[model samples]
Target: MKPHKLPFENRWSNGEHGWQWHCELERLGLMNVRAMFADHETRHPGKRAVIFDIPGGFVRDWLAFHDRRTARQQFLWRAIVIGLTLVTAVGTVLNLLRL
Candidate 1:
Protein backbone atom coordinates (compact mmCIF):
# COMPACT_ATOMS: atom_id res chain seq x y z
CA MET A 1 0.00 0.00 0.00
CA LYS A 2 1.19 3.52 -0.76
CA PRO A 3 2.04 5.55 2.31
CA HIS A 4 0.05 8.77 2.80
CA LYS A 5 2.68 11.52 3.03
CA LEU A 6 0.37 14.02 4.69
CA PRO A 7 2.03 16.07 7.46
CA PHE A 8 -0.37 15.01 10.18
CA GLU A 9 -1.80 12.04 12.02
CA ASN A 10 -3.34 9.15 10.11
CA ARG A 11 -7.11 9.55 9.95
CA TRP A 12 -7.82 5.84 10.37
CA SER A 13 -6.12 5.81 13.76
CA ASN A 14 -7.32 9.13 15.12
CA GLY A 15 -8.61 9.67 18.65
CA GLU A 16 -12.26 9.69 17.56
CA HIS A 17 -14.29 7.17 19.57
CA GLY A 18 -15.79 5.66 16.42
CA TRP A 19 -12.61 5.53 14.40
CA GLN A 20 -12.47 1.77 14.50
CA TRP A 21 -15.98 1.42 13.11
CA HIS A 22 -15.24 3.63 10.12
CA CYS A 23 -11.89 1.92 9.57
CA GLU A 24 -13.61 -1.44 9.36
CA LEU A 25 -16.16 -0.07 6.93
CA GLU A 26 -13.42 1.37 4.72
CA ARG A 27 -11.73 -2.01 4.62
CA LEU A 28 -15.05 -3.47 3.48
CA GLY A 29 -15.58 -0.66 0.92
CA LEU A 30 -18.53 0.92 2.75
CA MET A 31 -18.88 4.19 4.59
CA ASN A 32 -21.26 5.94 6.98
CA VAL A 33 -20.24 9.57 6.79
CA ARG A 34 -22.84 10.73 9.29
CA ALA A 35 -21.32 8.66 12.04
CA MET A 36 -18.00 10.42 11.57
CA PHE A 37 -19.61 13.67 12.69
CA ALA A 38 -21.56 12.72 15.81
CA ASP A 39 -22.42 9.42 17.43
CA HIS A 40 -24.28 8.46 20.59
CA GLU A 41 -24.35 5.39 22.72
CA THR A 42 -27.12 2.99 21.84
CA ARG A 43 -29.29 0.75 23.96
CA HIS A 44 -27.51 -2.23 22.46
CA PRO A 45 -24.25 -1.78 24.26
CA GLY A 46 -21.91 -3.45 21.77
CA LYS A 47 -23.14 -1.48 18.78
CA ARG A 48 -21.27 1.73 18.14
CA ALA A 49 -21.50 4.31 15.34
CA VAL A 50 -22.27 1.66 12.71
CA ILE A 51 -25.58 0.94 14.50
CA PHE A 52 -26.15 -2.18 12.35
CA ASP A 53 -23.79 -5.01 11.55
CA ILE A 54 -23.35 -5.09 7.79
CA PRO A 55 -22.46 -8.61 6.79
CA GLY A 56 -19.76 -9.15 4.20
CA GLY A 57 -22.23 -10.39 1.60
CA PHE A 58 -24.26 -7.16 1.76
CA VAL A 59 -21.47 -4.60 1.94
CA ARG A 60 -21.47 -3.93 -1.82
CA ASP A 61 -25.23 -3.65 -1.95
CA TRP A 62 -25.25 -1.35 1.06
CA LEU A 63 -22.67 0.95 -0.52
CA ALA A 64 -24.64 1.08 -3.77
CA PHE A 65 -27.89 1.78 -1.99
CA HIS A 66 -26.41 4.51 0.19
CA ASP A 67 -24.49 6.21 -2.64
CA ARG A 68 -27.48 6.13 -4.99
CA ARG A 69 -29.64 8.08 -2.57
CA THR A 70 -26.90 10.68 -2.17
CA ALA A 71 -26.46 11.02 -5.92
CA ARG A 72 -30.20 11.44 -6.54
CA GLN A 73 -30.51 14.10 -3.87
CA GLN A 74 -27.54 16.10 -5.19
CA PHE A 75 -28.72 15.79 -8.79
CA LEU A 76 -32.19 17.06 -7.95
CA TRP A 77 -30.85 19.99 -5.94
CA ARG A 78 -28.34 21.02 -8.62
CA ALA A 79 -30.91 20.71 -11.38
CA ILE A 80 -33.31 22.99 -9.54
CA VAL A 81 -30.60 25.58 -8.85
CA ILE A 82 -29.34 25.53 -12.44
CA GLY A 83 -32.83 25.80 -13.87
CA LEU A 84 -33.67 28.75 -11.66
CA THR A 85 -30.43 30.51 -12.58
CA LEU A 86 -31.09 30.06 -16.28
CA VAL A 87 -34.61 31.41 -15.99
CA THR A 88 -33.44 34.48 -14.10
CA ALA A 89 -30.65 35.16 -16.58
CA VAL A 90 -33.01 34.92 -19.56
CA GLY A 91 -35.56 37.19 -17.87
CA THR A 92 -32.91 39.80 -17.12
CA VAL A 93 -31.60 39.71 -20.70
CA LEU A 94 -35.07 40.07 -22.16
CA ASN A 95 -35.87 43.01 -19.86
CA LEU A 96 -32.62 44.74 -20.79
CA LEU A 97 -33.36 44.28 -24.50
CA ARG A 98 -36.81 45.86 -24.05
CA LEU A 99 -35.26 49.08 -22.59
Candidate 2:
Protein backbone atom coordinates (compact mmCIF):
# COMPACT_ATOMS: atom_id res chain seq x y z
CA MET A 1 0.00 0.00 0.00
CA LYS A 2 1.23 3.47 -0.89
CA PRO A 3 1.49 5.97 1.92
CA HIS A 4 -0.39 9.24 1.49
CA LYS A 5 0.67 12.71 2.61
CA LEU A 6 -1.25 14.10 5.55
CA PRO A 7 -3.53 17.10 4.90
CA PHE A 8 -1.22 19.42 6.81
CA GLU A 9 2.15 18.33 5.57
CA ASN A 10 3.73 21.36 3.91
CA ARG A 11 1.54 24.49 4.20
CA TRP A 12 -0.32 24.43 7.49
CA SER A 13 2.53 23.29 9.69
CA ASN A 14 2.95 26.81 11.08
CA GLY A 15 -0.42 28.26 10.08
CA GLU A 16 -3.82 28.69 11.62
CA HIS A 17 -6.78 26.32 11.30
CA GLY A 18 -8.05 25.91 7.75
CA TRP A 19 -11.72 25.41 8.24
CA GLN A 20 -12.62 28.15 5.76
CA TRP A 21 -15.10 25.96 3.97
CA HIS A 22 -17.08 26.04 7.16
CA CYS A 23 -16.99 29.81 7.43
CA GLU A 24 -20.18 30.13 5.42
CA LEU A 25 -21.88 27.67 7.72
CA GLU A 26 -20.67 29.62 10.69
CA ARG A 27 -22.02 32.83 9.18
CA LEU A 28 -25.35 31.18 8.73
CA GLY A 29 -25.34 30.15 12.39
CA LEU A 30 -26.32 26.64 11.33
CA MET A 31 -22.95 24.99 11.62
CA ASN A 32 -22.11 22.96 14.71
CA VAL A 33 -18.42 23.62 15.10
CA ARG A 34 -18.32 21.55 18.27
CA ALA A 35 -19.72 18.60 16.41
CA MET A 36 -17.08 19.30 13.82
CA PHE A 37 -14.45 19.24 16.52
CA ALA A 38 -15.95 16.09 18.00
CA ASP A 39 -15.82 14.50 14.58
CA HIS A 40 -12.18 15.46 14.33
CA GLU A 41 -11.56 14.07 17.77
CA THR A 42 -13.18 10.76 16.91
CA ARG A 43 -11.53 10.58 13.49
CA HIS A 44 -8.16 12.28 14.07
CA PRO A 45 -7.48 12.97 17.71
CA GLY A 46 -3.80 13.84 17.96
CA LYS A 47 -3.34 16.20 15.04
CA ARG A 48 -2.28 19.69 16.11
CA ALA A 49 -5.17 22.05 16.95
CA VAL A 50 -7.80 20.30 14.88
CA ILE A 51 -10.19 20.31 17.80
CA PHE A 52 -8.89 21.68 21.06
CA ASP A 53 -6.80 24.68 20.10
CA ILE A 54 -9.50 26.54 18.22
CA PRO A 55 -10.62 30.01 19.35
CA GLY A 56 -12.78 30.03 22.46
CA GLY A 57 -15.63 31.86 20.78
CA PHE A 58 -15.68 29.45 17.87
CA VAL A 59 -15.62 26.53 20.23
CA ARG A 60 -18.45 28.05 22.19
CA ASP A 61 -20.57 28.40 19.10
CA TRP A 62 -19.87 24.82 18.18
CA LEU A 63 -20.81 23.69 21.66
CA ALA A 64 -24.10 25.55 21.54
CA PHE A 65 -25.04 23.87 18.31
CA HIS A 66 -24.03 20.51 19.72
CA ASP A 67 -26.27 21.07 22.72
CA ARG A 68 -29.22 21.86 20.52
CA ARG A 69 -28.64 18.76 18.45
CA THR A 70 -28.26 16.67 21.58
CA ALA A 71 -31.58 17.93 22.91
CA ARG A 72 -33.32 16.79 19.76
CA GLN A 73 -31.66 13.42 20.06
CA GLN A 74 -32.79 13.14 23.66
CA PHE A 75 -36.38 13.78 22.69
CA LEU A 76 -36.25 11.03 20.11
CA TRP A 77 -34.62 8.67 22.60
CA ARG A 78 -37.34 9.33 25.17
CA ALA A 79 -40.04 8.54 22.64
CA ILE A 80 -38.37 5.27 21.78
CA VAL A 81 -37.98 4.38 25.45
CA ILE A 82 -41.67 5.08 26.16
CA GLY A 83 -42.79 3.00 23.21
CA LEU A 84 -40.66 0.04 24.30
CA THR A 85 -41.89 0.28 27.86
CA LEU A 86 -45.49 0.22 26.79
CA VAL A 87 -44.93 -2.75 24.52
CA THR A 88 -43.23 -4.69 27.30
CA ALA A 89 -45.97 -3.83 29.78
CA VAL A 90 -48.68 -5.04 27.41
CA GLY A 91 -46.84 -8.27 26.70
CA THR A 92 -46.36 -8.95 30.40
CA VAL A 93 -50.06 -8.34 31.09
CA LEU A 94 -51.06 -10.70 28.28
CA ASN A 95 -48.74 -13.44 29.56
CA LEU A 96 -50.03 -13.06 33.14
CA LEU A 97 -53.63 -13.36 32.00
CA ARG A 98 -52.83 -16.59 30.11
CA LEU A 99 -51.15 -18.13 33.14
Q: RMSD in Å for candidate 1, one decimal?
A: 9.6
Q: Write down the TM-score for model 1.
A: 0.46
lDDT of 1 by residue, 74-96 (tens): 99999999999999999999999
**What are the models' TM-scores?**
0.46, 0.41
Best by the lDDT measure: 2
Clash tally, candidates in order: 0, 1
Model 2 residue runs over 4 Å out of place are 1-58
Candidate 1: list runs displaced more than 4 Å.
Answer: 1-54
RMSD of each: 9.6, 12.9
lDDT of 1 at 69: 72
